[model samples]
Target chain A: MIGEWIRFGITCLLLIAALVGFTAAVIGAYRFGFVMNRLHAAGIGDTLGIFLVICAVSVSSGSFLEAAKAFLIIVFLWFTSPASSHFLSQIEYYTNPHLYRYVDRKIQDGPHSDEKEPE
Target chain B: MSVETAYDYLYTGALIWLSVLILFMLVRSIMGPRITDRLLAINMIGTLVISCIAVLSRLLDESYLIDAALIYAMISFVSVLILAMIYIPVRQTRGKFEKDARKEIRAERGIRGSVTESGSPEYKAGKEAEKPAYEKGNAGLDNGRDTQQDASLQEKGGSRT
Candidate 1:
């Protein structure tokens, strides 16, 4: 009986930690002014928040098959989040004409090579 | 309390909190300033909902719900990819009205032969220092070599510090 209680306590602790991760991600998203900063914040929830939630679920259930399935969700998200982030940033860079305002673009061997780098 | 009873309370509380987070994400999505911001918020919402589904799977002891969460993750990821793909082929202009605004500004100034490159809010904000660079970038874009232009731009990221 005590062992079961201990297990429950662990599961609860993990779930709360996961909730904290999600909360931090949301707060960071709001506090950051730049889209790239916001993306950095959202990544916390994408990777850490979801990982902890699955950890909690697996711990509480204690079934191998269920844990495997839940683990698959994490694996799938881990694979895709970076790809989406890349495409989004590329879109922002290519489409936003005001890009030079937010970020300092160091012109390389392009036609604009003669321009002094913004200090 | 018994173990089952304790687990039930915990799961219920978690579900409540997840619902609240989902609501917050919904508001963020609606208020996001740019397409990327909205998409980012929507992506976060998808992650939160997956957690909710996972918690529900445990609380209800329905094993199939874990499968459901897995499917949801796949769908959310694919949706983001599809949206990104839709934007890749369009002409790399900032806004639809930008070209019109440039023409009007040029006409007002009586610059008949000079080309009017794309303009954005920053241009209107009186930051003309970057206009030359912007024009050069536009020149490359107008050559119809989208892939080569993108490849050259990608090199800039190496020194994005």
Candidate 2:
């Protein structure tokens, strides 16, 4: 009974936190308006926020074994996200430089040309 | 809804918010100032997709989504490594060489240049913009015009090239 209650409480806390983090992330994306930087913020929501929620839910389950399985899955995700983001950021920093530029910077390309042509 | 049923609401709402955030990031990746920005956005998208699959799997009590997420992770990792392996060092040296050449040219000609920007993308684009129109649909026409213009400029200025 105590174990189940503990799991339940943790799960409730996890969900609340997840909701808060997700809300903040969405708002952050709206205000920032850049994809390259926004990607890191999303990773936080999906990996850290979602992982905590999953752990809370798994621990609260009726069957200890089922909860353990959920724990294993959460662990798997926790490890994978960083590995992916690390490589992606590095490769992007190197090879495909154009793909990384912001919208405002692209706009500069047009205005600069106009100023130079001297009509 | 009962306490048990409430999990579904919490989970779904969170997912919806997460998806919207990911979509906005995707838009950024599409219009990144440089290629790196887009690639990083894409990487972020991949990670978000995996997390989305994980959440759906838990909500529905399914296991297959985990496998799909794992595969996505592997593919994204390999793609980034391949891109970096080809791009980094060559540009590092080439960038320095270009800067030195520009300084020398400025000293000799003393054009007292109005715009001396190397980092700007338009500077690179302007090099391409020098090309002329190919009315015959052959790209060679633009190259031909730029070459002629360059030659005439050099001759008038007396052997600058």
For lDDT, the strongest prediction is 1
lDDT of 2 by residue, B1-161 (tens): 35556657656766786688688768867766555556556655665565566567667866656566567667765775566566556545544543454355435433322263433466535543533333123334443454456435644665442
List per-prediction Cα lDDT, in the order shown: 0.75, 0.55
**Lowest lDDT 10-residue stretch of candidate 2 chain A:** A110-119
- In model 2, the runs with Cα more than 4 Å from the true position are A1-9, A19-47, A60-119, B83-86, B89-161
What lDDT is reached at residue B70 by model 1?
A: 91
**For candidate 2, lDDT tens digit of each residue in A1-119?**
56645554676687667656655654554344344455576567656665665565555444566556556656765676576556556554444323312322344354333211111
Every model's DockQ, to 2 decimals? 0.40, 0.22
Q: Candidate 1: list runs displaced more than 4 Å.
A: A105-119, B90-161
lDDT of 2 at B49: 65
Candidate 1's C-alpha lDDT?
0.75
TM-score of 1: 0.71
